[model samples]
Target chain A: MIGRLNHVAIAVPDLEAACAQYAGPLGAKVGAPQDLPEHGVTVVFIELPNTKIELLYPLGDASPIASFLEKSPAGGMHHICYEVPDILKARDQLISDGARVLGDGSAKIGAHGNPVLFLHPKDFQGCLIELEQV
Target chain B: MIGRLNHVAIAVPDLEAACAQYAGPLGAKVGAPQDLPEHGVTVVFIELPNTKIELLYPLGDASPIASFLEKSPAGGMHHICYEVPDILKARDQLISDGARVLGDGSAKIGAHGNPVLFLHPKDFQGCLIELEQV
Candidate 1:
């Protein structure tokens, strides 16, 4: 079961401009950009009082967010992550409830180095959801 | 300045289905639908530990999310609400930093009965941002 709202990930076309916007006008504390080659994306975290806003940019040639950026050239809210206590149990519950898991239904190392799995957007009201074990 | 992430708003085509998805498969606590005729939205709040996910359905002919729903029939992230201590001060700071505020730049009563203002998506990495006084 989902526990806490982990982070809302926004795919930005321009990472520097996005960081500046959040740090300057938004008046938020933004972390330095960290490249995650394994995830095929570079991420900058905007720390909030209760949660985080992750600014994502495509990294490798087969970056997962590349198509998302193509569909939304100016970038957009890519996904919302929820923290789960036991990811395998959570996945099983979701599956039993008829919700489809993305990829090979396996958890992968996410940007935060946590085990994460994505759920099909169609099953989630067109909102891409990421479940991260916390 | 933006403080906490108050909630993430998702405009869903089917309100009942959206609520079921969250309450069932997602294992979130979903509140009853509340109609906000003035704002042209009927909403169901999914209460998370740190924040909320608001599922929005069109309430009237002039619903602000009508066009968004037309574009994304399956529903999608509409906007993100960030809580601020002083909305007027936050608006002024955002304006000074070259961010465009939607409407006449005046704060209006939001869904939670707090003063809120929306920022232009073009200036915000294509993400609609709502600032609410908390």
Candidate 2:
């Protein structure tokens, strides 16, 4: 079951501009950009009172967000993550409930270094959902 | 300044199915649908530990989410709402910082009955941002 709302990821074409917008006008505490080559994206975290917001930019040619950015040139909401206690159990339960898991149907190390799994958007009200074991 | 993330709004074509998906497979507490004729949408609130998720469906002929639903028939993230101590102050600061405020640049009563203003997606990393006085 989903616990806390971990973070909402927004894929932006200009990472710096997005970071500046949140930090400047929005007056939110934003973390420095960190490039995750494995994830093929660079991420900046915006900390709110209750949850965080992630700003993502394509890092390499094989970046997972490249296509998303292409489809939405101005960038857009990518996914929303929820914290789960046991990702494996959650995955199995979701599978039994007829929800499709993305990738190889296994949890992988997410940008936050937590074990995370992505559910198919078709199964999640057209919103990409990421489940992270916290 | 933005404080808490009040909620994330997702426009769905099938409100009941979306609510069932969150309550059943996702295992989140979903509230009963409430039709806001003024807002031109019916909303179901999903309560999470940190924040809420609003599932929206077009309620009338002039529904604001009708076009969004047409584009994303399966539903999608519509906007993210952040709590602001003073909506007017936030709006002025955002405008001074070169951000475009949606509507007539004035706060209106939002679905939750709080003063709210929407920011242009072009100015906010392609994400529609709602600022609510809370």
Candidate 3:
């Protein structure tokens, strides 16, 4: 079902400071910040040897990250993304197993330009899990 | 500084129920629960192709997971562990960069029998980060 650990997303109140932390002390390559209006997030990717870390900030008031930040003023670990070979198969299998997909039960293009679906946090023990097609 | 994603930990109220969800619906290979008295938690590993997901439950009332579950009764994402070739180097670098290492700023033997150190959530945008010497 799950392939690789695609990326771990961290919601930050200050995206630039978060990027600087990774790029400076962590000695990681940080990519340019890209805003995805559909997702309502502005994200920057910190490339690592085996996986990537996504630093996300709220794009608008309607952004989900905005609510998350309200609960946690400093921001926090938002979600963990796992890659799957087949998005449709994984989605169907998950749905059959009683997992609730966040949106309209359909995959949406994510920050990486890949099909992604979010599983309800309650279904995953309060941890928001995202499955992305790789 | 980070080598690879060792695991993403989720704190669950019921360890068995969480295991059943991953093993049954997710079709993941769930490992036996291991109790870490020092850490005050019982954890099970769900192995994926690329990385592992650690299901954590409170071992006792003093467990940190106990408090986490108090706020999020349903449980939720606990922390993210990243492998580092040298834990000491990573710790020093992180500290020098104004990151606060938790629990006396020393490494402890984790579930994988590796030297692990946890960074304060506030320093990393509220994300509790664990660095393991792999």
lDDT of candidate 1 at residue A63, scale 0 to 100: 96
Q: Per-model i-RMS in Å? A: 0.9, 0.8, 1.3
Worst 10 residues of 3 chain A by lDDT: A20-29
Model 3, docking class: medium
Which ranges in model 3 have alpha carbons more than 4 Å from their true place? none
Report the lDDT tens digits of candidate 3 across residue range B34-71: 99999999999998877888999999769999999899
TM per candidate comes to 0.98, 0.98, 0.95
Q: Model 1, which residues run further than 4 Å from truth? A: none
CAPRI classification of candidate 1: high
What are the lDDT scores of the predictions, listed in order? 0.92, 0.92, 0.89
Error of 3 at A21 (Å): 0.2
- Please rank every candidate by DockQ, starting with the best: 2, 1, 3
Error of 1 at A103 (Å): 1.0
DockQ, per-model, please? 0.84, 0.88, 0.77
Flag the better candidate by DockQ, 2 or 3.
Answer: 2
Question: What TM-score would candidate 2 get against the native?
Answer: 0.98
